[model samples]
Target: MAYDADTSIDLTQYRSLIDLIESSAKRYGDKTAYVCLGKATSFNEIERDSRYFAAYLQHHTELQVGDRIAIQLPNITQFVIAAYGAIRAGLVLVNTNPLYTERELIHQFNDSGAKALVVLSDLLPTLNNVVASTQLKTVITTHALDLIAPQPQSQCEFTTITFTKVLAEGSCLAFTPVSAKLEDLAALQYTGGTTGLSKGAMLSHRNLIANAMQIKSRLSDRLVQGEEIFVAPLPVYHIYAFMVNLVLYFERGGCSVLIPNPRDIASLIKTLSEHPFTGFAGLNTLFVGLCHQPEFKSLNFSHLKVTISGGTALTQAAANVWQATTGCTISEGYGLSETSPVVSLNAPGLEQLGTIGKPVIETQVKILDLNDQEVPPGETGELAVKGPQVMSGYWNKPQETAMVMTQDGYFKTGDIAIATEDGFHKIVDRKKDMIIVSGFNVYPNEVEEVLSAHKEILECAVIGVEHEHSGEAVKAVIVLSSLSQDLEQTKADILRYCREQLTAYKVPKIIEFMESLPKSTVGKILRRELRN
Candidate 1:
């Protein structure tokens, strides 16, 4: 888990990822940086657009240096412009899920104290309701076609400030040059709020650049200078996809075939069949979902050289089906929002089918017990990581941040894993009671806490149950203080309340009523016992 030798990346090439785009704009100015819905954005065009947006934000808005800006958009080209523009403006970025509810959206916006938000048109209603309570002032919205050229600018149905307006306003605004250091905070990635509440992991520019290089060094041969093609279906808001597909891939001047909506499996299959891809990265359920589709067998993946799976364990069955359909194995890996999302991965050259491979270049991983003592190899323990890619700390939550970080700068991942002799590692369990439903982490503690607050429920416990489509489904066991006079109506009420408060994946599928609950000797609820 510990590296004795050096794992340094050459810093002479570029100071940060933004610098990579700037450098590429100079070298491969006319090359395509992004491809979406048959429309492409050239490297030079991207640079000019981002710089203009950055200049506009700095001059028009009162956002100071290091102020956070929330970005909630899909896999469209605006995401790239907004992301790079925020960074270039010397502001930290806070990526948000477009599917978040008003409550979930409010929590993150307030927690990060975001000064502005650049969101898609469709998700504006969710943001509009909560903007009053949050510190956010400037709200910039764009349509999907705004990023693509040769389209009429007046063809947008969205109701907000458009890109055209921003450019016009920026005409008279004064531009101030600001220098952003390599070690400055770049992103505040919020953890998957499955445990209790989400915490923002503060990642610096150096952390993100180092992680990209770590991945680049491992697959340098497969990824040519400017010819690499990646199938980017995962949500850009998620850390895994953002780092691998958006940040790292774009920094290399590579091409990404964007899948705006992955839920449409048929459309995804057609898109894959039409294009040639060199790399594909996603979670276990995505591969499983595709393989189960009847049309998946007809797609051609002969050109694919590298495949990666993360965010959860790669089930053995899913791996076999993928390898059988395509001549390449699906390399499983592990990471968290705290590690710039790439800590370890199964190297394509030397991969174990069922295990997430060793730590990436410049990263060190260790398995430790509750006492922070190192555990023997092949034994399950909490996975701890220390590297340039690891987050500096959580934003504003000093006590919560200090609770997970070690004195030596290692972040306790809270994931249980066993490291093999061949450096392959397999995830066993998560310290936080979390259920991954449809490749999304659903925290039981958060659900249980919310359910227990209900007037009908006295105590509750939540656990994951096996499911074929979604890897796992949330199931809740409740001990009511008073017997339900109308059981069916009470169940419906609880489900309805959960739907309003939680996301679709986090809602419990099954609700069981109990007269009494299982507990430890100290009267603490035993969630493990409820699993049975």
Candidate 2:
């Protein structure tokens, strides 16, 4: 509704994401493309290194054009090189979380059927036990300082080669050009499902390119070509950052200052002080955590013009504190992994607080009732979106895909929303039992499955509780077995076991023991009663 038919754009210029990468390299060769751990990698360097990495994947490995390559590293320069190279080699990028447990890694790797993996060196000890269980054949490891200088190599059953070595070997080999069509799969981004395990959302080059262009067009007034510097604290593996930092900012010739660990608030604040960033991307907790630090408030805010918020709903508390500190208004956006992540973002100046502003250009969003018909104006209902940025469907799961998609083309986002009379959309509640901790989606069933496996626990129900630090924290209520000994000790043991199976964000922060969990007459656990 924002743009008319006359302003509608076509995708004739850029063939694929590769075109955007090469175009930026040529335009801003000497400009900084990415900065990580005090080192700046220019656009030309990214181009050359990515080309080398792609060459090795093409000539050295036994990988085909459409094979999946998993990348499990924090926000580092290697992530950019590896992601770009994998795409250039005509392979589908499977962006993996660096903090994923062995169980998670096994499910994702086997689900995506990834043949190769590029992981952090420190994680090799963990991956050492897991790689043999998956379909991964080639494992390339890299340290944080690998690009700056060769770091000591760590060994594992499969992770014997370093990322540096691949680049060097690739430089010698004659590189063959691999062209991927826009309709081809670019990445398999995994998102938490209602089921215990997660599923991969198949995204095409067109889906990504369209979203990037759509957001860019929306924020055209704020972003300046070759001048903007976007501080990226969120994980690059996530679709939100992947679309914003990797595609949008990179194509616009903006430098992304990568923060490896956002949990380390001091280090994150220090990184901010070093760069005269023009833009920032973060979630509610990150915004609140950074604002609480004394070192953060004193930083220069003159250069900061736009602050983008996604991942979780932006709390009014976070928005107020961030604006009071950075002197920049927070533009909160609403999206899901199935939508290449951004459907609506608050407009730059006309931002209406407590609302996700308006839908981006070429995006159609409407609320649907229980009968799948359009809800009355200003009435809360399920939000369904029809957009070019929307993912084709969930990978390799026809039934799951059919469940979310409508008869027409709209993808039914499992969140309750209300459309304002003035064209703004506001999300009110989640239709699914998903818990959002910090910016990550944690499913109740996923955590409950892990807790149920513990010998000490009989039955468990996981629910989201309001957390001051993380937007919401996972709270597990359990009905202990008769065999259980000390209640407190059992709680500790169950939590310890959960940490081993689930990621840090997915683990239950609070555990409660009760005689029995609240359930209905049919014996189904009532999670709402637990939350109450």
Per-model CA lDDT versus the true structure = 0.81, 0.89
lDDT tens readout by residue for model 2, 262-377:
88999888888899999999988788878889989899999998899987888889899999998899988888889998999986666788988788888998799887789888
Query: Which consecutive 10 residues in model 2 have the weakest lDDT in total?
Result: 1-10
Q: Per-residue CA lDDT of candidate 1, range 253-305, in tens?
A: 78888888888989888888777888888777788788878788777787898
Model 2: which residue pairs collide? none
Evaluated at residue 141, the lDDT of candidate 2 is 91
Worst 10 residues of 1 by lDDT: 150-159
What are the TM-scores, per candidate, against the unseen true structure? 0.93, 0.97
